[model samples]
Target: MSSLKPILLVEDNPRDLELTLAALEKCQLANDVIVARDGEEALSLLTHRDPGSGEFTLVPAVVLLDLKLPKVDGLEVLERMKGDPETRHVPIVMLTASREESDLVRSYQHGVNAFVVKPVNFRDFFQAIRDLGVFWAILNEPPVTTRRPPASTYAKGV
Candidate 1:
């Protein structure tokens, strides 16, 4: 596992954040987890640029996003990310407590890779998080990006 790739967690609720962190820790996932308190912060982190080099920072392996958030909601965030070519490839999982069918439909429409309802029971929540961490961080294969040849190269046909 590449330690450079972090897991982006966008959750506003402190208790939920703590519980999620604990669950991930208990599962012993080696990847680092970066927390974003709200949707705005999550977007900032994902699109952050270095002042000196003007280069983007770490790209997360996966994003665990909550539905209800401050500044911007999860669905909006998902929409923005999916719309942008730079961030569109990053897998986003809707990890929320909402059971609304509309939210689920909208999430999938906005290109959310997965949607997981937060379990109320402690044991169930822990197990769910653990499974999610294992699958996304260790098992899932991200899409491969192929660079398009330059127009000149194609023009030459050599």
Candidate 2:
């Protein structure tokens, strides 16, 4: 399926980022992938509003976040996003190499939608990312919101 929304990838490691991107590309998912090298950059992108439209620019179908990052950790980013009304509905997946139990617990506590442990082997990593891409970008169904007319407008029309 063709996805209009982009996928947000917040990764700090260059090699991992390269590998992840390559894996996603191999999957041939139609959605565009936006990369942020740091937590600050990710937050900036997530919160940035367009001057003309007054709407946020970084609405993604899914967010693949690394646990460890510079300037602000992934947990902090996840917390901020979950706390914000506008961003709370966006699905966030913690994609990290860390296997600490505390990190997993903390991520779920902070309201991460999914958690994926990065595989050490190149082939395993590639397969894992491809599966993630296919599932999130293709199979997952997100909540749909419908716009309603204001009371004043409805009364006037009536």
Candidate 3:
């Protein structure tokens, strides 16, 4: 059931990023991970044009977001994703260091599918990433979309 779709990691801290990537590497899911250094970059990579390419391509899969980010914050990214019709169905899991009650409440309210607080211990962090990878990549059922082919495919005479 592993779709091989890329996992989007939206994190700002270098240490956390390294740890999470390492944990993800240990997991059964060896799927390619796309990393965005900040919330703005994360949003662009996930929902908008690729900064280097400027193409409207669909990179299907879920987003693992961190709350505290530079530029556009995680909450803002979540809001934009949930607000848009095209991106709303994409599952967004919040993986952040913040344990504030308000952060949790706002995340869920903004339609985050899952919320995980960063574990202080290395073992716990690894376990959390592994579990997250297993569940989202294998267990979860994403929405299905049906669409007509592009105009180029249609007969010009008709």
Quick one: best lDDT, which candidate? 2
Candidate 2, 1-158: lDDT as tens digits: 23357788999899999999999999998777889888998898888766665667557778999999999999999999999988899899999989999999999999999999999999999999999888888899988733221222111000
lDDT of 3 by residue, 23-95 (tens): 8778857456778888888776665544455533445467899999999999999999999887788889999
Q: How do the residues 16-42 of candidate 1 rate in per-residue lDDT, one tens digit apiece? A: 999999998898887778888899988
Q: Residue 100 CA error for candidate 2 (Å)?
A: 0.7
Poorest lDDT segment (10 consecutive residues) of candidate 3: 149-158
Model 3: residue 81 alpha-carbon error in angstroms: 0.3
By summed lDDT, the worst window of 10 consecutive residues in model 1 runs over 149-158
lDDT ranking from best candidate downward: 2, 1, 3
Candidate 2 error regions (>4 Å): 1-3, 146-158
Score candidate 2 by TM-score against the native: 0.89
Local distance difference test, each candidate: 0.83, 0.84, 0.77
